[model samples]
Target: VESLGRDGLAMAKSLNMGNIFIRKKDSNSLVPNCEKHGVKAFSIEAGRALKLDYDYADKMVDGLLNFLRKVGILEGDEETIESQSVYTTKEIVPAPISGFFKPNATLGEKVKKKQRICQVTPFFKSRPKSVSAPVDGKLIYLRSEEVVSEGDSVAHIIR
Candidate 1:
């Protein structure tokens, strides 16, 4: 598991923003082979609701232990692991024109199809273009940069 800010931007280590979940078996069945070589693997992506804290650390540890148990590497009672669904399809909203971006929704919030999520106002005198959600899903990422160029990714909604 790895933590990243909205828009997949690298954040300070202290900030536990979100996680990227890549399945161990989604590709070439490498996870099983790696395990034969004494390596462990996971296939879930988790996003924290807050910054790095004791609660977050504890949850991580518990998740690790539970995973080990599930794979028969550790012996223990079965525990239900709460996790977020992995989304293969993502709606990436790009800037329509060069401008300053102002966001209308918080990161990780649920958005409906066609919802207005942000606006891009050009540095000059042109009108601002409102950015809308393309699908009903969770807003996984939003650009933190104030200025954006045309075609720059502004938001990502996972469905």
Candidate 2:
């Protein structure tokens, strides 16, 4: 059965969208259940939580239409791109200590293992906690809020 939660990277490459694989294993979720049941399902996180970006919406619509065409479910041409980025290896780097997070890596930036991605300064006067990359990958997401608590997700990396 196709992992729709589709072969995520495949759909992204076909539609030329920002290809990010959501890693959620050993958890209760519908996507995985669909896979087990042989139901071809797909999941996509379109814009931010509340706000809507019309341009992004339009792009996604176009991609969906093109995907239909590419699969022969619809007529006409497909606008498949030459090469698209597929970010896999999902890693959520958590804050080691409760403090304010100061990021050293920007989103979409490539980082190496052991590289300082951010530092959390404690509320009390003391040395800040050094947050380093656990693996060599691209920095995909970083928390916007500076105030962080222990074990909070500070960064997301994908290889």
Candidate 3:
């Protein structure tokens, strides 16, 4: 198994490794072979293979329990961690079009489904395009306001 960067995929294809799991964010639903030609393709979280935090063993066990519960390997109280939340990297929102993104909400704000989250406008233009939360979540970040191209990450919503 190798890291799934651009060069890594090129190398994997050259060697004919039938199954490759690219990082979820790197995949494109548009490419048909990206799904069909590979024997298997998926993504795994970063902390799945390592300790989430070295200081707290209890937190580690709780994290493992969360995974087991997710995969149906173990079952118990559905709300074991009432305050805990987990999010994938894909939850990070990117600009749909090249523009200047201005967030109306601050980070860590609890947002409901369909609530306005941010606004974006083309560079040097006046009118803004409002971006909304697709699901209930908390705003985790607002990437700085330098410049964002189409598909460039502008914020993250942790649901």
TM-score of candidate 2 on Cα atoms, chains taken together: 0.75
Provide C-alpha RMSD values for all models, in order: 9.3, 3.5, 12.7
**What's the true lDDT of residue 58 in model 2?**
93
Q: How well is each residue in 1-159 modelled by candidate 3, as lDDT tens digits?
A: 234555444433332222233434434553434567765443322222343635445544555565455546777632333333334332667787778777778866888877887878887778888877777876766766656788887777764
Instruction: Write one digit per residue (lDDT tens) for candidate 2, span 78-126.
Output: 8788566665467899999898889988877989999999999999958
Candidate 1 residue-wise lDDT, 39-110, digit = tens: 854343344445455775776676667655655678985464233454546778999999999999998899
Q: Is candidate 1 or candidate 2 better by lDDT?
A: 2
Task: Give the Cα error of residue 16 in candidate 2, in Å.
Answer: 0.9
Candidate 3 lDDT: 0.58
Q: In model 3, where is the ten-residue run with the lowest total lDDT?
A: 11-20
Q: How do all models score by TM-score?
A: 0.60, 0.75, 0.44
As a whole number from 0 to 100, the lDDT of residue 129 in candidate 1 is: 92
Runs of candidate 2 exceeding 4 Å displacement: 1-9, 18-27, 35-38, 46-48, 51-58
Better of 1 and 2 by TM-score: 2
**Candidate 1 vs. true structure, TM-score:** 0.60
- Clash pairs, candidate 2, are 3-6, 4-41, 5-41
